[model samples]
Target chain A: MRILVCVKRVPAPGSRINVTPDSLNVDTNHLGFTTSPHEECAVEEAAQIVEQHGGGVTVLTVGPSEAEEQLRYAASVGATAFVLVSNDTGIDWDPQQTADAIIESIAELEADQGQFDLILFGNESADSGGHQVGIRVAVALGRPAVNGIKGIEVGVQGVTARREVDGGYEVYSLEIPAVLGVKEGINLPRYPTMKGRLASKKAEISARETQVAPGAQQRRRLHQPEETVIETEILGTSSDAAPKIVDLLEELGVL
Target chain B: MAGVYVVVEHDQGQLAPSAGEALTAARRLSDHLNEPVIAVVIGEATTEFVSLCEEHGIPKAVSVLDPQIVDYGPELWGQAMAELFSLTEARVVMATGTDRGNEILAQASARAQIPFVANCINAEFSGAWELTRMQWGGSLLEDVTLDTSSLFISYAHHSVEAEPLAAASATQIESIEMNLDPVLCRSLVQDRVTLSEGTTLSTAAVVVSGGRGVGSAEGFASLEALAGLLSGKVGCSRAVTNNGWRSHADQVGQTGTRIAPDIYIACGISGAIQHWVGAMASKNILAINTDPEANMVTKAGYAVIADLHEVVPAIIAEIERRRGNSTST
Candidate 1:
């Protein structure tokens, strides 16, 4: 049961995030980069599936050259292979171009080795949150796809996926060679060990380049929402604050 | 005629809140574009659904009815919506940024070979579609333009308040027949497992949320008690759910549930960007933490500089005592 996971690199926003002066991108000078939170869980889920099913995990990302850091991080954890589809144009690819590139990459990889049994993607990108790439890829591939899945169970015939709704979980059963857009709560991603880090440093990364066409959506600019300063009133220390809380709750008419 | 089309969401014939929100957004767009508002309801299209649309001042409502589409499948709904768009020739398509909304619009956009933007807070159309959309779950904003002929957009959750027109107009219901293929229905909802019965975290008036500082699953009992006293629901941060202390359904964060309560009492939460986005819509926020410099403490409207374990019980006791005094009086 070979599995493939797609991930994205985003800014690791600590307390606050600022936009560039031109409002075209995030200011990265003061920020660090990490894999999107949901995709980290997707990588972890793929690793767990391979650990139990006796297969290997392949991780891929379509981003700038610096995105190799995220791919290496996946290798350090448990992924057996890493592919970086480099976009050196310094401009973000629209969802259509990204999906097309991924589809082409999948086809080429399958031609070399064999077809993967499963494909995974984060439910949405943490930055853009377009919620389109996975569904588009699945449609183009003519495979069953389920999004916002929190739980998955692999079986002999098919796999069962669970998605959280407003008050309940909606379950779906899809055949193999299917795709899933998973959320963060699916699994807790593990950290890399010293041996794993050393192995990842020596691991080989495959880089591929593809032509990208402009799509229907074009980003014009980026801006920050007006900030509302909130002044916090500290009640007291210890249990003595209980009465103040009660009084405030009463004032808010929630008591 | 060119108009704004809204996809209405319904549950067992009752309208969902997102339906109203979508209608509100469509109305706003119609006001700017000078076009009529058209609603698309996918289901049995009962009288209730039509009447609800009429009450919201929708001039025309399209019902895409088929037996195969008893429940939602993204592909099937998307196919139906694409057909409706062609038949109606609507200019813009809109839906709320809920799970079903985003999924259906995504499929529709893909099938139509167009670009679809999700979680948009504001949209304006002069010649091209200019919009401000939420990025990183509202922590950042991106201004973008859509060069497509037909625009597809989804409103961010709680971005627009649901409002009705002053004078309701009579809605014309139009029924459309669809021949859905069985293959498109392969991803239908098989079953549903309900975690809680009533008063979900999103709809609760008051939310008492705990975080990593709560220690363990057992630590949530105090939060539950306090929530019970306040007639509220218990919510947890992503860290608590990640630690297996609570179910994902009870989590308040970007990936979980976006809650808009009257008051949100955050206990021991550090207020990460993801969690803060979900709780930012609350009318008032009270943070209880031992560390006064925590993000939650600094950004909240009021802070209690103390440990929540002791503070929660004392607050519950005080509420009960006040109730006892009133009853005796």
Candidate 2:
């Protein structure tokens, strides 16, 4: 019944995103950082599973030392233990390198505390959106894995996962010791309580280092896409604009 | 090293919408590389599907028809693709960046011990293969260089328009027999549960969407009313869904439904990149928000700088008034 969840720290973007002057990274001078939305839900789901099944949930992240913020945030909610696979967190490790580092960290954790029954990850990191790290880890571990899962039901010996499809959903059943890449909306993450905040401040975080080199995909630069300039006809303001809206709707033939 | 490869996806005996576009992308790579375009189709494919390949400029396709391959199994499909790559010696492999497409390609890349890239908008060889891919949905772009013996990538959804060759070459479907490993079917799609009956978010003609400024679940009532009057559907942003104000099924974003309605009325939405990617496909957009600098307001075709609480009811009343006058007359 033991579960592990992986998360990443990402810059919380506003209405617009700007690249660094060197074109290497996101300009985060004016932005705050938060756990990727999908991974936040993953941590919540893991906590709920342990609450029902009576097991500990361990949160893991492979990023720079600053990512300890995300680890502590996981503690504030429900994660009982934390592991940070520390590296130069300023830059992103390609998907292959990231997966390799995670697999090595998982081995070390399992050596200390028996094997985890299930491991969860965000469907994709908000910033990189590589969509492969979880699956790559699953393959390397020789376990069944599914991505884009929204619904999960733990049974006695297996798990039922539901992925959203066009009309309904496609369900899959995998035995224990499996991995899953869950998306947001799988569950509503709970807010941290005052007592939980105090406990998280005292929690100890274990750090691990990775020596894996960068993979084949090397980024040259990041840039904002050219915005299409639209005139954006402002009809009016407040309720006075209602008549103009009706006229426009009529012109568009929706009325 | 011999040709460019594309994995064709089909469901219920018809080609998926992204299949033709993937083939067209492969055609571009094939022509540039001066190599043939070889499509790999697992399981059954209709005649129309094969014709689609030809129309999209695919020179040859390899089909594997096996009972175990009848259903969608990520591992099995991945193995098929890995085998096809070795069998064909494909120089580059690409698929559409759908959930299934990304999964199978990732699996294949893992088995082949190669790096894979997703959501690529464009790629070409300039001393090296330079790729321009979408990051943060479609709001930002990243220029990357992938140094691999055989390239693996997926095209961004709806990024490339599907085009037919002016003079299509007669496409031949060659049967490449494969006895897939039975163990690979462990991850097969086991069951299906229908959440709603019909007229889902992606299929709606008009979509009235709400965001964090919608306040709460009950606050969505006005949006629902507007959608109901227009016989459309109601959608919300990820923020609203995360706040427990609406169901994930009602969310509009990169992780949720990608909708292309006739008109999308966005209320109280700041329009983050994730949400904008899904709504950008709508033919027309109207934003009602207090912040005139919001991304949705700036990108919209029309805007009203006011609170939706006031604007929505007024729009509803005006429509009803006009309807009553015409009926009375």
Candidate 3:
């Protein structure tokens, strides 16, 4: 019943995202970081599974050294183990390189401890949104994988996963040692308690390393899309605006 | 000869909404690369599917109809696509950037040991593949170069309008034979559970969305009333969901449902980038907030600088009054 969750540290974007002068990375001077929303739910889902199945959850991440903060956050929220596949390089790794590094690290961890029964990942990173790492990892490992999973249930023989589709859900059953990419709506993650925070501060974090190779895709630059400034027509400033709104709705054929 | 391949998504014997859009993208690539475009269908390419393709100006298509692939499985579809890529020596593979579309293409590209890009808005080949893709849900754009000659990419949803060729010829559908491994079926869809019947958030024509200013879960009552009166749906921002005032199912943002309604009524929302990316696709936006300087108010097509609590009830009453007068007449 051992479970592993993979997460990414992303800057919590406000109303707007500002890029660095070089356009190579996000300007992080005043920005704060948090685990991608989807991966936070993945960590929560893994922890809840272990809580009910009588096992431990391991949280893993691949990012800069500062990502250790995210790993510690996971520990505070029911993760029993932490693995940081350190990427000290300032430049972001391509999807292929990231997937390769994660696959190699997973093999190393399994060599030390027994193989995990399940591994979970966010459907896509909030920043890059490549939507490939989990599927690539599963394909390399020859394990069943599905993305956009919102529901999961563990049974005696296999695990049942539900992927949200239009107007319904598509359910799949896979044997143990499977991979899944969970979305944000899967669960509402809990906040860290005082005791959990203290424990996480003292918890040990395992750091792993991988060789970097040039990936097929390389980022040239990042730029913001030109914002179209619309001349917003003010309907009114008080309840009297309601009639104007109704008239506009009628013009839009909504009424 | 190397050709461009586009994977068409279908459901319940009809082409999915993004099918034509994906083909349009492939057609663009095909014209620029001077290669033939072929549509690949994982399921049976029925007469209706062929007609739809023909209507969309598809010149050629390959149908991979295997009994083992009765249900959708990422691995199975990936392998099938991988086989097709090798058999045809495809130069480019494209699909719509959907959950299933991205999954299947990712798996296929992995099997082919090639690079895959998602949410690409534009792509061109000068010498190598240069792509402009949407990052942060279209708030930002990333220009990247794919070193590989064989390209695998997904078009950003709604990036290109679906248009049929000016003079499209009869579409030719050819069935291809492949040896699919049964192990891939491990990821096959085993069951389906219908959550709700019709008019979900994504499909709703008009969406009345609330944000943090809506106050609490109970505060969504006016929103629900407005949506019901408009025969639309009710949505909330991520803040409302995080506050535990609304379920995540009702959230509308980059992390939530990407909605494309005719008109999106945003109430009490400050309009963060995450939320704006989802609502930007709507034809028109009307923001009702007390703060005139809010992002939602400034970016919206129309605005009412007032408290939603006060304005929503008034709007509802006005609509009812207009309706009653028309009925009396």
Candidate 4:
């Protein structure tokens, strides 16, 4: 079965993240870019699915031209094709507009090739975390969609998705032509081999320009959260600290 | 439709704490907009649930009951919410930022063709609603404006404390009938697999988490023993899960469960940005690592510079010794 995976290019955060002086976006001057963690796993999952079944994987992203790095990263892993929905405006698209642009891209691709059996997306973007684009795209496409999925089993008849709930896992069975917003830990994404990287460098990336419209939700600004000053109390060294820990636990009534 | 509404979440005949928190948020919005707070109870909206809402100072409740609504079907629940919104003309709709809460709101927003915001810590209504939403799981904050006829929002999980109002109020329950499309019920939850019971990693009062320094899966047994003594649960970092030392359900990171336990005891974790985002909500953190300069040690409220392998067993032994002495006394 054919599968499609959507990914987002986000700044690679280290120990700390600094926002732009204007509070409009992340200060990428010191940061590199990579695919969001969840989407990276989605690409891996798609590759594994195609390896088991006889099909190909297509990777798509709606970002600036530099986002091709993420698409190429997917290609290096195992994706057969890549689609970049290039937006040169340098402004982030709202969830509604992002979903619309993805829908348009999907329509165009499906027109050339048949509909993909499964579509995958990160549960949410690491940066925006709007948590709406995937579900909105699924609704617009009129397909069954489930988010926060950690496990997926593809069967001849349908697909089984498992979402980790409190104290248990909630399972859902959806037929083909379904969409899933998968979280990280679904799989351990594999590193790109030298040969695969060389192939990815030679791979042709198809680019499409999509017009974006303003949505109801508008960004006002960005700001850092007030940091709570934490005073680290060193109890003791080595095993001697155990007594202090016990005392603190007893004070907290947990002992 | 003009009043603020809170979507109540219930499981196994009891209201989720997130529901209470959502009501608290709704009450704040109600005070700001000068509107009544209404509770929208879906699925098994028993009388007991309505009374729980009343105790929280919600004077009015709308119950949408249907057989297909037994489990969380996003489409069906969203349809019910949309119908309720039209029936009550709710000005603002709020739910807790759990899996179901966010999904149902997404469905409702899509069906109503409106904007839905998730993980909002604060919201103010003055002609247009201004919201402070958590980005990257609270690592960053974004100020946004929602210019919609009707607003849909979910509170950041555990961001607001769930507290009841000072004075209890009488509640009026209104039941509504909804026509749910059969297609919406197609994706209903089919089966549930219970891995562990009692305290879960997210809701546990005390969480003992291990990371790369734990070495292997067998190394976690000691941490588990320590957690058991404290009536807590064992969690792991993304590295442990990636190494197959633990299941993804037990992974604590940006992609895994965001935990807000009363006290989180992190052992061997180096405190990467991904892991810190999930554990930042803990009321207090105690880091046990060999490296004094480890991120976890620097950021934690308390630190013990020691090898967890030795310190953990010592702590466990000390706790058991204390327990035995208390019993003998």
Candidate 5:
């Protein structure tokens, strides 16, 4: 089945993310961006689905033209085409507008390409970390939406998705034309290959107008919180200290 | 009153602590916004769910229950909740920045076609109308003025300290008829299994955790035995879970559940920040490792320099022997 994967550019993990002094938004001047970890996994899953099922795959992003790099990154990993949807500035749009933009961008792509049998996305964006777009877009399209997915399988019958829930994994078997939001641990995303990188640079993409504008909506005054720290020292250890440690854990309520 | 919307999360008749945390934050944010805090609980049943709102100090509780809404389905929830948001026209709708919370807000944002800020740790109003929420994982702050009839945000539950509960009379609760249909929900919970015993490590007061140094799967039984003795929950590092030595639900790290236990006894844990972020909120930490320089040792309240294979058994024996007469605390 054909697939459409939504990718996002986010600050890489392990890097410190700083907010403005007002705390209403991120301080983006210094931070580096990469494919949101979960989105990378989504790309891997889509590639796997296409490889096994013999179908087309399209990587789409609704950000500044710079986000084409993110789609290229997806193409390097195995996506068929990269589509960039932006107006030059990747202004901060809320999750709703972002999803609206995705729906529009997908429609524009489908108008030219064939309809997608499935749409894949990350469970939550590592940078923005809101995790609202995928399911919201699913609602707009009225498709089956699954989040926290750890494993996925597609076959002659249909598509099967598994996600971690309360105790164990919950497996859902649904017909095609569904949206699956991948979690980080689904599978370690593969690095981009040299051949894939070369192909991505030359990939052709069409631009379309999005009804939703990032700045169209209003926001409020942003302020930072006071930093509170409790300084303490680590105590030494000993066989005799086991009792003391127990006492401390009990006080801390661990014992 | 310009109402504050408090969004709560529950699955299979179980409530997540983030829901209460959201209420605690809402109680304060509402006061600051000059509005009343109203709790909105979405579930298939309202009998017990509504009472939980009274505990959160909610004056008005709206319960929308439909069998089709069992799992964390965004469409059904967004349909019911968006209708509520339109009716209440809340100054702001805040849910805990959880997987499900983000999903609902995303759907609500689409339906309302509004803007939403995610992972906001703190926000202060400059006047009757503007909000500035910090981004970049609490590293920097952005200042922006908001202009919308309703504002949507998912407050990172870890950011706000849980507000202390106040003893007061019961609050008024009005149940809203759910206008959603079973056939309308495309996705479903399908199945739900209640944690029979020893779940909820995130909120547990004490956690008896074992890491890679504990050796094999047989070694876990000893840790479980110790956990059972203390009435504490069991937790593991990401490595242990990856090795299939323990369940994923009990894993603690950047990818796993973030825990705020009162006392965290990390046995054989090296104390990486990835692991620390998950349990750094502990009132006191006791990390036992053979290596004196284990990273977690430096942050630990008391670092026991010893082999956990030897130390854990001894500690267990001591607890069993001293059952009644220990003044260590």
Candidate 6:
């Protein structure tokens, strides 16, 4: 089995995020980047599959050269190959365009390998989190697709995967050449070790473009969220009240 | 030019509540767009399915009955919906944004080759879509302009209010039989795996959630008892899962399940952005924490100044007292 895991690099989870100076897009400048935590789990799950099934793991990502870091992170988790599809077409493509590019690039990558087995991806990327790429990729590739998978195992004919539904876990099995959108808790992703990091350094990632792009735009409406965020600040009263605060804190055993 | 296309999701015979919520979204969007709503339910059932839809507020209900579609298969649902989409020029196709809803939209988006957006919290129509999309698990908002004349959008279960219309005269229902190829599909729902030992979260009305501040793994019993008294579900924070205090299934976050309950009470939870994102849409939130500075104190509908040790037991006692009072009455 040759497993392909797709990932995305976005702003680190804890870092402060900002829109561009023009208030148009996420301000990529000044923010640290890392692989989406969910994708990390997907890579770990794919690695476990290869470890048990005697196969190789390949990582796929869609972004600029900066996105190679996500692929490297996947390699550090035991992926053997890396494919990057960039849309340096002087514009940032929407989710559809990104999926199209990934669809085309995945075909070429799988064709080079001659026969592909599994395609694993995060349920949604942290930043874009479009939640469409994997499903679209499955459709574009004409393969079985499962979403929100929490657990998985390799089977004789195909693979067995478990996902969350309305009531409980929905168990499924699909033949090779299928897609799965990995949810958290599927597996505990392993941290990159010194050895795995060094192996990742040696990986020369592959990248390309796609023929399909966003065909048209739709109407409705868009804007910022209506919910208001208010910050509150309260100050302690006078010195006498400060002593009372200390007494109250002592009563609560905070002192 | 304005009409609602309700995306139906089902497993075996039971329909996901979000299916009803999808109909709600469809009705609301259609109302906003000044268009009528049409519901498309795809299943293997022959007769009962059509009436089930007609009883609901779905006018022009199209039931694509096929015997082979026993489980939720995205391709078959997408293909069937695509045929329906061709028949009707739906200005907006809305789904519940569940595992199935999101899947159908993704497949339909690719098949239709149109821009697809997921988990949209707000949408408007002034000729084009000015949309506000959640980013980084709702940590921030991305305001983008989708000029697409028509597109596929899945509303996250709790993101949009599921407001059904008042029952009017008999709703117009239409059923259409369709053809589908079961082969070329790679996966099937073999069985349902149990996540919780009891009380499916879907049935939970009032939920009491815990967080890292709960500290010890041994204290879950107290929380469980409190939840049992309220007939509610037990919820955990992502931190608790990370700490292995609870199983990941009980985790409440962006990755975890999104629920809309009558009342959500938080205990010892500082409320991370991700956790709040999942629970923010709850009808009401009451928080009890030692740290008065906990972020949720402001966000919750009500805040209590007490530790889990001191407060949860009291809440349980109150619930038991209420039950006793009701029984005596």
Listed models, DockQ each: 0.70, 0.72, 0.88, 0.73, 0.34, 0.30
Task: For candidate 6, give the lDDT of residue B294.
Answer: 80
- Residue-level error in angstroms, candidate 4, position B168: 2.0
Q: Candidate 5, after superposition: displacement of residue B88 in Å? A: 3.9
lDDT of candidate 5 over B152-180, digit per residue (tens):
77777577766646763476666677657
Off by over 4 Å in 3: none
What TM-score does model 6 score on chain A? 0.82
The CA-based lDDT of model 2 is what? 0.87
In the range A141-197, model 5's lDDT, one tens digit per residue, is: 777777778788886666778777645666666666788888766765676789988
Off-target runs (Cα >4 Å) in candidate 1 are: none
Report the C-alpha displacement of residue A192, candidate 4, in angstroms. Answer: 2.2
RMSD of each: 1.9, 2.1, 1.0, 1.8, 4.9, 5.8
TM-score of each model, in listed order: 0.96, 0.95, 0.99, 0.96, 0.79, 0.86
Retained true contacts (fraction), each candidate: 0.78, 0.80, 0.90, 0.77, 0.36, 0.41
lDDT tens digits by residue: candidate 6, A1-255 = 888888887775432356655555566667678888788888898888888888898888877778888888777779998888875553356776677777777767767766678888898887667888788778877888878888888878888888776557888888776788898888767878999999989987877655664544332222234556643222122222223322332343322
Provide chain B TM-scores across all predictions: 0.95, 0.91, 0.98, 0.94, 0.80, 0.86
| Model 3 chain B weakest lDDT span, ten residues long | B10-19
Residue range B85-114, candidate 6, lDDT tens digits: 766776777787776787788777677666
User: What is residue A177's positional error in candidate 3, in angstroms?
Assistant: 1.0
TM-score of 1: 0.96
lDDT string, candidate 3, A1-255, tens digits: 888898999999888888899998988888999999999999999989988988989899999999999999998999999999988887679998999999998898889998989999999999999999999999998889999999999999979999988778999999989999999989999999998898789879999888968888888899998778899999999999998899899999988
List the lowest-lDDT window of 10 residues for candidate 2 chain B. Answer: B8-17
DockQ of 6: 0.30
Quality class of the docking in candidate 3, CAPRI style: high
Q: Pick the candidate with the highest lDDT.
A: 3
Model 3 preserves the real interface contacts to a fraction of: 0.90
**Candidate 1: docking tier:** medium
Chain A TM-scores, per candidate, are: 0.95, 0.95, 0.98, 0.97, 0.85, 0.82
| Candidate number with the higher DockQ (1 or 3) | 3
Strongest candidate by DockQ: 3
Task: Put the candidates in TM-score order, highest first.
Answer: 3, 4, 1, 2, 6, 5
